[model samples]
Target chain A: MKNTYTDSGAKDTRSGFGAGLLELGRRNDRVVALCADLTGSLKMDGFKKAFPERFFQVGIAEANMMGIAAGLTIGGFIPFTGTFANFSTGRVYDQIRQSIAYSHKNVKICASHAGLTLGEDGATHQILEDIGLMRMLPGMVVINPCDYNQTKAATLAIAEHYGPVYLRFGRPKWPNFTPEDQTFEIGKAITLVEGKDVSIFATGHMVWMALQAQKLLADRGIEAEIINIHTIKPIDREAILNSVAKTGCAVTAEEHNRYGGLGDAVAQVILTAHPVPQEYVAVNDSFGESGKPEELLAKYGLTPENIAAAAVRVMERKKH
Target chain B: MSITKDIKELEAWLPQVRRDIVRMVHAVQSGHPGGSLGCTEFFVALFQYIMDHDPKKFTMDGRDQDIFFLSNGHITPVYYSVLARSGFFPIEELRTFRRINSRLQGHPATHEGLPGIRVATGSLGQGLSVALGAALAKKLNGDLHTVFTLQGDGELQEGQIWEAAMFAAHHKVDNILVTIDRNNRQIDGDVSDVMDLGDLKAKFEAFGWLVAECENGNNLIEIADALLLAKSLTRNEKPVVLIMHTEMGHGVDFMMGSHEWHGIAPNDEQLQRALEQNPETLGDY
Candidate 1:
């Protein structure tokens, strides 16, 4: 496997969603878009401009937007609802539960501005528990892509798959490293680096941090493996087990709470199949405050240094 | 759309539907019957007399046909009865209301693959938005069929309902009809006591809806006329709403006009008394 990745550029993941949605509008007439007064923030202006008749502007009402999306599916329309991650998941959870998930509607809940990366918006806009809330719903597909290209790929991919999905992305411009022409297979993990010391499982923006951590670990002579777990629900258990079997220990990293994000998902698989030493690099059950994205990430211990430290700690806990 | 069936033939189904509603709740010993009984005339008038739908060929998309969403899904007794009697499913399925492994869930759900339900909506204040979506879908598909939704008066207290009200008006979602079952009763007591819905028609009108009212919701003629009037009011660049004034339990004497029986099943004697009041015209399910 390739051990090194080069960043082509830096771009916000929400723009990738916009590019994908605009492309979808051109490709499929059935595809429609809805936004709860955050069309520009969610990067849905291209879609709105291209498909004026198809786009629905539900002003400031997340719950109604969710319901309308569910209803749109009944008439054979594929509705993609866009909003901030907090409003998309938490504010409209019941509407999603009964109207979309339980009803089994084919609605794509595209949530941007996830986690502390939503910079200066504070805890109110930055949602760390959205992954848990969406993944817990039966038949809900929870996806948190690592970067721009992957987010775009996942957006197009979910349009093909007929079911409810919660596609989470972020606000800040991060490294664009993933393949631009990649096919995003749901529930599949991408192994970024091959190594034997420890497995570093990461999702969303944290995957970039894990890549940096791998380079840091390499300097210390530790060959850390990095796998991008983009799809949190229907998680790729085989990839997790295979990596841990070779490495004997693991470190989970995500831009979410440690309790119910990628770490817990990885731990559940490891505990059930192969018992392994694992460390978590995530928010320690605390809400984020208004600050620069990089500052919050560093203060909350979600940087490359923190991931590298967690990898070393887990390696120490590895038996033998 | 015109009422295709004779008003007498449509009225003939009311007693049997009422019997099914009471017996279904009584048999399960759980389920909401008051609202079910209250909305019997409206359900019958829509499913049997008014809606342009084929019960034998049910599809989830509901394209090219008028679709109805029950926002106040607790009243599944009436919905199930009307659907069964309309040939959406076997009439015998009414016996399985709220029973284990039955399509007739305690609340109306599309989860069990029930024939008529397009969306699961026990959670209040969501159906109007859903109906507007379907209406929009119909517009996009060039189907031109209207979408219908029923909401409980108390359900308007949920903020989502008002949000949908504002949305429907703002978007010019004109191809849908929303009927509020103004039964004036909720779980706690009179809806006035729990939380007053002051001047509901005026509120909907202010939200840019063409509002209609049915003074006697339990009467089939009034409901049919109101539904027709509401249907006529659609496609005029404004959504239509019918404020239907109804008694909580309309058919049975003991249960009528009270919130006490909103969710409780009628006991054996009460069921016997309720059955006596509405003689089964079409055989019970």
Candidate 2:
């Protein structure tokens, strides 16, 4: 649960996606890539350099890129499309809905600069609602890995999975705490700590914060159960139900809007099985602005302290 | 072998297609008949002789076979009829046209598990991009088969169509052929007065596509020649665009040249009158 390795360095999940995509290019000839004018930002330069013929520069047109990706599926090519989270969702939702999601194409939509942590390009660029938007579409797999290693594994896994997948990652460097060799599994949650007082469910960059909060809660004699839910849709209902049944309370945290995202996805699972007191640590119906990633997390109430506070509040709400 | 035999065969089957259109539209009480009747000859030519396609082993990766996409999906009645007549599905399923649980929807969709449809396309201006995408995919996969698509002239007004046009040309997507249904009519009005797609052929050429013109889409000989020319124009590098001039209501004299009947389903009386114009080509479905 702790960042025990002192030499551990932080790396952006987008870099992980780029690295994974490069590996895929080397291994699979059918793994073609498309970028909506953000090759360097999405860390797709490695793939582009290695397989120049397979890489398509789609300019700034995300809609066209999505349709093209759908078309590529017909010819049995697995296409990985990269862009900012905002453009990946908002600018091309209809195209994705009709061409990719509806057609059930094997297209990997790799999104970067997710949540308020994207920092500085303001509310327009920092997309906190991408998970909500993508998860709403039926037959679309949604994944938000916690760290670099998990993200790379997810990028590789989604390429092999034969269907539409939205892989959401971020721009900032998070604490690289997950084991480097762990394989990514869809619809499964990774339990980081065991507790009985309350369950703290989180995903994406928020998983790192939830881990920090676990330490803080432990110091306060609060044994908080922490589960990292990388896959948002096809949520780990079994893990959530089991954890909440033991803890009798839960605190959900994510670097996303409170209405939808990991917190909402977790709450739905908990609500259907065992009704329990739940507190959410997420953006409270407000758009993000230009700031440092850590600062934005703090401002948006998604920091470790905020999650710890939410856990305490939920634990208090738990009646014997 | 002879034009007389071809016309006799067409003349025999054209009425059945017409009756199928009317009966299907009447049975469902929904669907665009004008365009279906309008584009019959073109559809007949493609299915009967021109296209090297088979419904049995439908694959999105048409490596060895030609592919066709319906960009203007409102003409589903025609597409569904031709597809059924050509053996993509049991012609009996035609009775369920636009019915719930039927593969035949108001617009063509792949969701119904329709064999020949690769992508679900009801919204205009999207199929062209998908076709271009498929075409590009074919080239990347070393596929020798060509891709084909038909779009309504009014559909050209969509910004996505222009985007696709630019994309196909910029990428030199030469393994695909695109045909514009230059029927000059849309749901709202005549294409020219509605939104004037001025000089579409020139615009396509400007976009760097090899261009062809079909004077009469209903003329089997002309359509066959145009498709052949378009095929020859496809050089595995530059996409082919053909401006197919078609009457919105070709066989049905009462429905031609006016936007009023563009999407209006013919009533029982109108349907009967329309049927009298063309003799039963193939047996009535």
Candidate 3:
């Protein structure tokens, strides 16, 4: 299981989004991109340069960008809006709810710099609660892909999916491990490693942490299964139930808040059907400050060591 | 669908439309009839005369056809009446306004699969941006159709509207015609008393939009001509906006000229008088 996956390289997930968007620009003429003055940061410059007529630079207005994205759907065009996670969800919640989510528009809200991985921008820019806000909306597909290849695949996959979607990614260059040609499914969880001792469900950047934690648990003779739960809403319940049925305990890992992220989403699925012992390796109820990405992950208990500890703790609870 | 240029034929629908506005609100005992009556002629002009649209062939993707968006969605009595009378949906559905399990929600919505409403909008300052987006789509597809949006004078206070206003002018979104229902009234009070929108014509002009004004929005000929003028102003590398000045309650004498009737429905006797004021030319729902 340890030799099953390897890091292809280190690349920012936003670049994957840019790459996917550029591909979508050529593949689908109806695909349009709109950025709120963060073209370079969101890595949408490639798509903008390639399809200048289709790219809309909406200055710094997030709410207007959301409404415009919703509007663009009315004319049979799939509009992908680019901005930071904070501005994408919080600043334009009403606009997204009324225009995009409620109206059931085909708009992909691609948000980069999600969670504490946004690093030095601090809590205002690094939104840990965007997943909660977006997943709470009815008919909104919330996706947080793991790596550059996965992010690019998810970007292309979401364009084919009709309806409102909130595609969240990070800024820092992390381990790009997923296969380049991987077929990204919206709600299907990918089982990265097979084991029966305990299930380690992870999403976004935490999937890498979970894999590292798997190695640590394996060294301790605790075989852990790693499943990447990318789509938060319309979560892969069948995959979760099947995995947890084999492994009596679970550990949910994510860079988001513990209250309403993948942990809670998994908890609800477990609590309703298969009752199991679980522990959350996520940001506890608190705001994050500016720091290095690795330092923030360590400070917030989001590293592989914390995930392994959480898995061990959950396994302990399962023993009783 | 042919555009109705006859002001007499368009005006005939006005009295019945106004009747429907007051009656629908009176039946529900809730809804904004003041702005509904105020924008009667404007809706009639757009749906009946001005816009090149097909109500019978309504699609969510209104490709190759002019589309209208109601930004100030509270005045659904007028919107629903105009849409119903224009044959977007059955006129009988007008009875379901604001009712439980009704396609017609309190605000216009696309959630219920309602025809003629492309977006859900009770939230102010959002519709203009959506309309601009549609306009951009038309340009991208090389579709010669125009997108239209109507906003409340009070809705301009919303920050997103200014954001959209600036973006439309800056991008030279020349395929859109935005109309402001300058009814001078909001739910709280008169728009002037609540928040002063000083010199809107000059403000829009400063935003780089070609601005036109219709002094009497209740008059069919005036609104129709103004809409035609606004249409003529399009394709000139600039977005066009029509500043339509109208009384809050235009037809109903008792409800006229006051902000008190902005959201409150007329009582039974008041409804009778309102209907009496505008004799029913077309049958009511």
**Candidate of highest DockQ:** 3
In model 2, chain B matches the true chain B with a TM-score of 0.94
**Candidate 2, B1-285: lDDT as tens digits:** 344456446555676787788778877678888888888878877777667777777776776788899988888888888898888888888999988898887887777678888888877778888887787788787878888889888888888888887888788888888888898988888888889988877888798888899998888778877887788888847888888898987778888878776666777888788778766756777
Question: Which has the higher DockQ value, candidate number 2 or candidate number 3?
Answer: 3
Instruction: Quote the lDDT for B176 in model 2.
Output: 84
Look at candidate 3 and give me any clashing residue pairs.
none
Tens-place lDDT digits, model 1, residues A1-320: 65568788999999999999999999999999999989999999999998899999999989999999999999999999999999999899999999999999999999999999999979988899999899899999999999999999999999999999999999999999999999999999999999999999999999999999999999999999999999999999999999999999999999998888889999999999999999999999999999999999999999999999999999998866
What lDDT tens digits, residue by residue, belong to model 1 across residues B1-285? 445457667888889999999999999899999999999999999987779999998999998788999999899999999999999999998988898999999998989999999999888888988988888899899998889899999999999999999999998999999999999999999999999999898899899999999999999988998899889899999999999999988989989867999999999999999999999898987
* Complex DockQ, candidate 2: 0.72
TM-score, per-candidate, Cα-based = 0.99, 0.96, 0.98
- After superposing candidate 2 on the true structure, give the runs of residues whose Cα lies further than 4 Å from its correct spot: A1-7, B1-8
**Candidate 3: misplaced stretches above 4 Å?**
A1-3, B1-5
DockQ of each: 0.88, 0.72, 0.90
lDDT of 2 by residue, A1-320 (tens): 43232215899999999999999999999999999899999999999999999998877778888888888888889999999999999888988988888878889999999999888888989888899999999899999998898899999889878899999999988778777887889998988888899999999988888888988898998888889999998898999999999999999888888887888888898888899999999899889999988888887788889999998888778864
